[model samples]
Target: MKRFVGLISGGKDSFYTIELLKQKEYNLVALVYIKSTDIDSYMYQTVGHEMIPFYRQVLDVPIYIIETNRKAINTDKEYVHTLNDEVEVIYDHLYELQKKAVFECVSVGAIKSYYQYNRIKSVCDRLNLSVLTPLFNLDQRVIYDAIIECMDVVIVKVACTNLGKEIVGKNLNVISGMRVDNWCGEGGEYETAVLDAPFFKKKLRIKNYEVLHHPEEEDKERTVFFMKINEIEVLEK
Candidate 1:
């Protein structure tokens, strides 16, 4: 079996990519997570990332957590090698891991963001590792339907006016009936975290949490909501 390193962000798309790769007989040997200092990073997800450690227990795999300042020093359509860029930070971490263990490829879950996809591909190209993106360019509605049907996902963050604090901590299924800019949250409409999935050994239950609202400074009509997970428990599936 070909060994692959899975990039996890504690989000629906990244986690779902692991499930897709496993189905194709890829060996998920290790997981990599980037802890960005910037909460609003264009290249990474920072909301609800504090819960990422629990995923190691759920997936039964070793995880490597790296920290980045989340700087977009190189924002060009084609990425260039720069030490300060967030993408280079990812490359540096993966490069070091490759020396310790030889993995054939890396897995990603980019749906429609060519900017993200291209940057990741650039890193893998330099490392001589193949990039596997199972969810690339797929229809958002189709992906949303599949995710809700197979996994237990929760809304962790809302950045659009159409959604508010009331939507926080709710199941992803609830948003299906409501009108939104993107079904899969691809347009930054919202963000999600997986509580349970078929590949997980256990499920997460949020015992206590607080919803925080941050109104946009320039746009009074828009506000961002986040579900701060104060307490969580692991349960048998």
Candidate 2:
């Protein structure tokens, strides 16, 4: 069987990529999570830092966390220059996952962002591995519905601009129509992680969730909320 490594961001796009690739018979060996450095860090199209561990547990996959943090550089050209440094750091860790023969393919959750997708493709070229993106060309709306239909996802963090306050602890199903369109559930408008899904041996249960609102005080900006998970319980099936 051909072995591969999947890069998971614990969101709809990554989750959908995994689902689609599995159907195509790729031997998924491990998960690669680019751990968040700080809120200001690139976040690699992800939301929060705390959600990584939970995603690993639910998927029952051994995760390799890559600390992609470095000094800040704002411009697109500067960002790409820094990316080379970050990819080197991650490649060292990726090498250790399967020491004998490096991963044949590196799966990413890229959609419409050419910058993001090409960055990963460049890394694959350097690492000598194929870059697989299952949801690369799919319509965003279709992918979002597939996630809602196939997985048990929960909202965790929302940027302080959109519907951040009302989403804390609310399951994705609650926001079905124009509400999701407003948030761009597939994009990086908000961030989420999976608690349970069909492939899991057992479902995950979350308890003691607190809704935290961080209001922008200086210039009358919007207030965003975080679904702080004080406690969680993973029950057996």
Candidate 3:
């Protein structure tokens, strides 16, 4: 049996990657996630502390949450520096997992960003692990639709400035049309959580959320609404 490890961030791309892998019937070894040590180094989809538990329960798989302080060395380099640091941190963790000697493939939820995808690919090459991207080069809208149609998704955080207070706790279907285009939440307008996807045996029911807004820098000029998760429940059907 071929074994694979998935790098999940609990976002659209990562979640979609997992879905595609399940379709291929690869033996999933573990879900690897990086817990941000501080907000300063939190560049990639590293949201708040909610990710650790959320993914564990949702994936229903063994999770390796590594704590790393890796950050971008250059303000000018953007994703290159930051993504390279992340790949290093992930490779180190995977090396530790390799002691068990089960996983030979590392699947990622990368799309469009060759800088991000190629770094992981290079590391996988060095580690002698096959790197697979289930969502590579696909249209962003198709990815979003797949998540909504096939999974129970919710917006846990809206990172963009234009979403305002209207988005927190709202379902994807409710926040469609003018809101998505104007704000571009799918294009980094916000971040989301897969409360329940098709892969799950049960769906997650959430309650007691409050919408709050924050103003971005003068140049961005948009306000983002943070959805504070007060209570969550997993429902059985």
Which candidate wins on lDDT? 1
Rank all candidate structures by their lDDT, best first, as comma-separated numbers.
1, 3, 2
Reference-based TM-score of each model: 0.95, 0.82, 0.82
lDDT for every model? 0.87, 0.66, 0.67
The residue pairs in collision within model 3 are 161-222, 161-223, 185-189
Candidate 3 global CA lDDT score:
0.67
Give model 2 RMSD, 1 decimal: 3.1
Residue-level lDDT tens digits of model 2 in 1-237:
566788877665676677778778877778888764555444353453456666566666677777766533433532343544544555566667657544589888877766567667766676688889877767777777788888888877676454656876778766675455533344455767676666666666677777665544445565666666667777776
Candidate achieving higher lDDT, 2 or 3? 3
lDDT of model number 1: 0.87
Query: Which 10 consecutive residues of model 1 have the lowest summed lDDT?
Result: 213-222
Sorted by TM-score (best first), the order is 1, 2, 3
lDDT of 3 by residue, 128-216 (tens): 89998877787777777777788766676766545555766667665666446522253566777767777776666666776655434
Displacement of the residue 34 alpha carbon in candidate 2, Å: 1.9
The list of candidate 3 runs beyond 4 A from truth reads: 38-43, 74-84, 179-186, 212-222
